[model samples]
Target: MKADSEFKKVLTLFPVVLFGLAYMVPLTVFSTYGIVAQITKGLLPAAYVVTLLAMLFTAFSYGRMVRAFPYAGSAYTYTQKSLGSYAGFFAGWVLLLDYLFLPMINYLLIGIYLNAEFSAVPVWVWILLAVTLVTFINIRGIKLVANVNFLLILFQVLFVVMFIILSIKALVSDGSVQSLFSITPFFSEDSSLSLVFSGAAILCLSFLGFDAVTTVSEETIDAKKTIPRAIFLVTMIGGGLFILVAYLGQLIYPDYNAFIDPDSAGLEIAAFLGGNVFKSLFLAAYIIGCIASATSSHASVSRLLFAMGRDSVLPKKVFGYISLKYHTPVLSTLIVGIAALAALIFDLETVSSFISFGALSAFSLVHLSVIAHFYIRGRKRSLSETIVYLITPLIGLTLCVWLWTSLSSSSFILGISWIVIGTLYLAYLTKMFKDKPPELTFDADEDIKVSS
Candidate 1:
């Protein structure tokens, strides 16, 4: 496409990675820390490690696809261009579940934490405030959003680092510095592979927004290189932070059963490690971090809708329209903010699982797209190439499937229902196979590269 018709390529590496981190929301490591600990039987670090490795594999596949496509579409573009139109439509549809609902889930999570701290404000009020603030920020534009995310991510990281330091100090004062290092965080008498894997499945939700970096590919400078690098960096840095926080958390609060409220376990750990002062600090950090997350989620989902709409998969007049002044998909952005209001009706645990299923399902398709694009279509027959194209993505695909199986039955029913709805819509769009699915028209001069 002509440069004038595409997203402005202004973002460099740092801001892009910050956007991804903001979307991932570093403080979320603690938000769900308690529940993951219970699942891992107190070996939270082990669970994080497993989840990180799986995410890394998926991140690699995403990087490969980003290099090949270098466009606005995320897994949808990748799968459609590499696999087929129908598969691509379904991939985009499944991903909509993640992109559209994520803001709601984050708003709900922040509401839970903030409500626990200030019950008089009411959680629904906080959710409303979050939707309003996040929607406004996103509609403003990507550059402004990136600048805001840089500050928000800095606050989240500082809080997490301070939390870790305080927890270590508490451990040392009780005994000595030696107490800071404990094998119990990774392995305890009750820990098992199955439990850790299950925990890893749930923990996968923390990695949801990393791939969202790809949604802004059109706006990224040197997108073919920058998008892939940002994906790997976000996954590694975010995963490392999660592992460290979980380790220190387990060390400070060793027993899962000891928590007064299993859902808010990190709160108890905050109190034990740093008293009421730190507990209050942690709550504030959690709320801001979630705000940052919702902001990024809104930005991403809006872009995805723009891509689909531009392709005529969605209503071209509405989702395809961009605000001439703000330079954003205003209608799409507003729809997301409205959808997030569903948080008022649903609880945290259920919505979180719902987001996970959508993300992992889309991730699995991305991995398959890599295999289909590289191994089957490219026809490159080399040992290293084979490993990169086939075996690596195979591992990623397997992990995504295993995680999908680990989700609750309700998630399956709900997620499948969403897909079924999408399938019907796709049929309508394709006219029951009488016509091809809608696709973006590219300029003949566009320097698009196929990985093959």
Candidate 2:
């Protein structure tokens, strides 16, 4: 493997945070609003609040880990350094599943939205167009993806702000303005703890992108400080967007039963709030948001594979190759793009569950890594440090387990099957635990090393 190729440190706080936001795709709040509200029985805001706080704990854990590792592998690097090679490999493998399917979910959403607008065009056409465009942007470089993501995220924010204002106006004109500030969106008589946590499990998907910031740590200047801040800010900002949109969206149509189809319910509300013209703008913004998300997803997943390949966990010649001129992982980018074509065969429900399961699994292990690294292995700590390192992560772990239980049975079966396959592959790689896996040094200079 060559050590000449490396990721340029062009990302500062803002661009890195923008990448996270784009990956999260704030407009997703509206895209899946009806189903979450249906699950929470009108208390969508409460669900987001729970999921946000839960994710924040995990976010803190990630921040701490990045300061120590500051590498491109995200949870894979953290868990490996904190726990062991085997644990890290599985962590990376699970996240690989998440990264692999995330582009599919984004393209699927684009296809679904486009299909709704132009019945003459098949959804597959829109999916292919989305994959092609995002792949091009990703292969160019992270800087381009960051620039594109910032603009698209701004457009998405404008659309959401416009939708909120229009919803308020529609309510005022109809003499029901009180719904805009009602507490029912946060908590209602029908809302229960079980239901809220269940909804949180679903909404956790919205927070998936924050951890991705850590994957770009090597490409970030002052990664130890910048990556942590980006992680925290992205989670908070994305959470705020989800809560605000869900709140206003609920105010517009407080009754989920009013939706003709819960899947496209947000479109119905868009039409009612601002007529067809505004609805068209809303659709355009959403499509752009999906493209931004797919672009970010591809960029991050390529980095992850590059990290793994650089470490000799996979084929170094292919997955680890980086374009010296572009400073991008060309082969890995194309691999993700090609794998996303599988999206055409699956439905939205299956992909959503797969993404959620893989993401939550990775998140749970990340929290555990914090405990493993700090409390169990690191030096003695003060009371405050103890709470930060141990107690908070334990709480985060419990919440993750609770959320994991909320996943569908199919998700559990499929997720476990993937894990089993990963274990089998690892056994082959290590010769049934008789040898140590390879490890690599990741830095801006692109140093490559192998440890037996």
Candidate 3:
């Protein structure tokens, strides 16, 4: 491994989008369908639409920031450069909660699913097996990860398509074509705008992958253009899949109260749509989806660690070192793999609480960064620039705050504790504010061409 080695620029827009969608795990809409359906009073599609519009505002901010700093580290890099080193450090630190634990959630999902299917095999074995496989693919390189994710995501999409077709068939068999065209999924006498917003807050987590694409900017060609385009495409495509699936699911099973269990409602719907065999296939697709999500998130966190390490924010020797032969961050990937083993001890609910906190925190900072870099600092205050840089991000920040208020008390406790620890570390690293924290170096000749 060479400390100075750069990542190979092998990714393009298509694979990058694949990585984002894989990280999102489009089939996730099925897993949470019942709970969201209940929350929205059967208006899942309306909730998804609200969530998508909110995410796009933040996605637009990400696009703006990536053009100015087309590097790895995502929000960490953007906030550090635009907002001051301290704010940037906290942004990266809090984001670590989201990036670091997401793979653990996937690993836990694999263990739980596999253990249920094959009771003879221990859950830890499945967790370890998944962690090993994902870690190995990530260590080999991003291209292989992208290729594997493409196949996994392809399976997920095929399953979603099958699910949609079956839902439509079931609906038509029971009713008429008019049954498929009802606005009840988007709005009904029982649902209200407040309930839709509540559901939107919950569904916001489904759009996590769009920002994860920014982590691979260093390994992407013409990253300034490609990364931003991939962000919007991923957000729109992922949101589209979620909204469509929710709409169809609501149509097929309009009576949300009929579910036996809200948490396992997807399984119930699967059983109804395709019977035992299709239900088994659905389980298999879900396991594959978990693997795909774990791999992408594993790769993402490793790159984020590498970025922080390269700037001497973390240990330069351990976290900063990239494999010369593989062009991947070997140590950082291994560290994430090891961290994922905690899945053996932690449950999904506990791990999930930390994710929304970190994601919302990073999103809020990115919006602020856009205003700091483009509006206040650059003095681009023309009417168009004001709308783009100020008003847009202001709306984004407000939505993030709204979502933040919806987070659980556990999320606040865990997130605040993580931030406190990070603050102490930053103090020591910067010698009690007597010194400025380390900064990422961007070379002038590095072809970081910004587009409007």
Candidate 4:
């Protein structure tokens, strides 16, 4: 396929709309607890501040790379160019572990929500049904997916707005919360440093799905501009909403702690004002948002597979196949659906620590890719571009390493195990394809040698 033709497939209003909604939900609801916890513990708004600063560094690195390469391969292409093929493939490979789990998380959460009302239908049934239903829709073209996302996102956004409105009504009835900030200490009186860190780290999970936009860069028209802008725009929108909703909860729900427990944890805050009725509504919203999360994940993983196929890292036939009618990856989509469903049967809480492991690792690589590219190509190239690509990635690397250390031991161990598995798979594929007609474009860089 001509590059332009392939890229054009991703150009649509649907992605933009889905992204806008995803950004809002996580920030408004999820971040309320974590961000507030971080702020209270740090004696200020450290979580929100850290998030913006961290994203700025990472986003800039992404912008520079997308403009330079502007291909659908994203991390696969950039890492291949800077770190070499093995590094690129493994970087892309490990990410599969994290993204691969998204559908599981989504479907599982959706089932739990549906159980609130439909006591008759088991939550697992709802999960299976949701995955089965969405799988066929995704098999259609991205155009249809995007169209559906636009409506789904609209409802998601509406639910959040409604919650805020209802809570505001309660606040007005009780007079005002203008002096409420004075009541809570700037620094946490209860939480230890470790507890606050763990809490803040959770926000990264909510922050992640938007990066999937890059996986489709190969299909996006004007992606070099649209993708990056969409990211920053979404972040600001979500960030502002997070801050507002946290304050709203604090203001309206005086006894906020009652809502949170081991079962619901950070989310019980929604139950306070909503009561039984509002709880049901927000619960529905949460599940729907998770479905959106699964949809976003499905779209992303298939693109990753598509790119891997292009590099001949996977069975070129399956991963590389695009539906002529839909211009989407049919087989890869099916694979993602099946894999996600498989994860559902697992007791993932035992493995949930590893969930964000590969994603952070991939983000780390992306940052380093920019630095490495400039460290090599910069001296012979434009100085400003070099600084944009290299310096920003260096900052991103520092932030990522800091966040990496903050991960739990369980996560670190599971993450490491996944990498080892990826290495073995790469070697097996390499040997199997050794006699094949097409060969992978292995990097010439000596530094990128595969461990196998």
Give the clash total for candidate 4.
Answer: 4
Best by lDDT: 3
> Of the candidates numbered 3 and 4, which has the greater TM-score value?
3
What's the CA error at residue 90 for candidate 2, in Å?
0.6
lDDT (C-alpha, whole model) for all candidates: 0.85, 0.86, 0.89, 0.64
Clashing residue pairs for model 3? none
For model 4, the stretches where C-alpha displacement exceeds 4 angstroms are 1-7, 10-14, 20-28, 31-46, 172-174, 180-186, 192-195, 253-257, 265-267, 348-351, 380-387, 431-452
Q: Residue by residue across 223-301, what tens digits does model 1's lDDT show?
A: 8899999999999999998888888888777778888988788788888888899888888888888889899989999
- Cα lDDT tens digits, model 3, 172-253, are 8957787788878887888888788877776777899999999999889999899999999999999999989988888778
Estimate, for each residue in 1-452, the C-alpha lDDT of model 2 and write its tens digit: 34565667899999999999999998888767888888889888899999998899989999999988998899999988888888889889989877888889889989988887798999999999989999999998889999999899999988888887776777688686565567888878887989999989988888888988898887888888999999999999999878888888887778887888888887788888888998899889888988988888888899899889878899988887888778888989999899999999988888888878888888888888988888889853689988999889999988888998988898888888999999888889999979878876445344343221
Per-candidate RMSD, Å: 3.3, 2.3, 3.1, 5.5
Q: In model 4, how large is the Cα lDDT of residue 375?
A: 64
Off by over 4 Å in 1: 1-5, 443-452
Residue 97 displacement in candidate 3 (angstroms): 1.3
Worst 10 residues of 3 by lDDT: 443-452
- Estimate TM-scores for all models: 0.95, 0.95, 0.96, 0.85
Instruction: Evaluate candidate 2 by giving its C-alpha RMSD to the native, one decimal.
Output: 2.3
Which ten contiguous residues of candidate 4 have the minimum total lDDT?
443-452
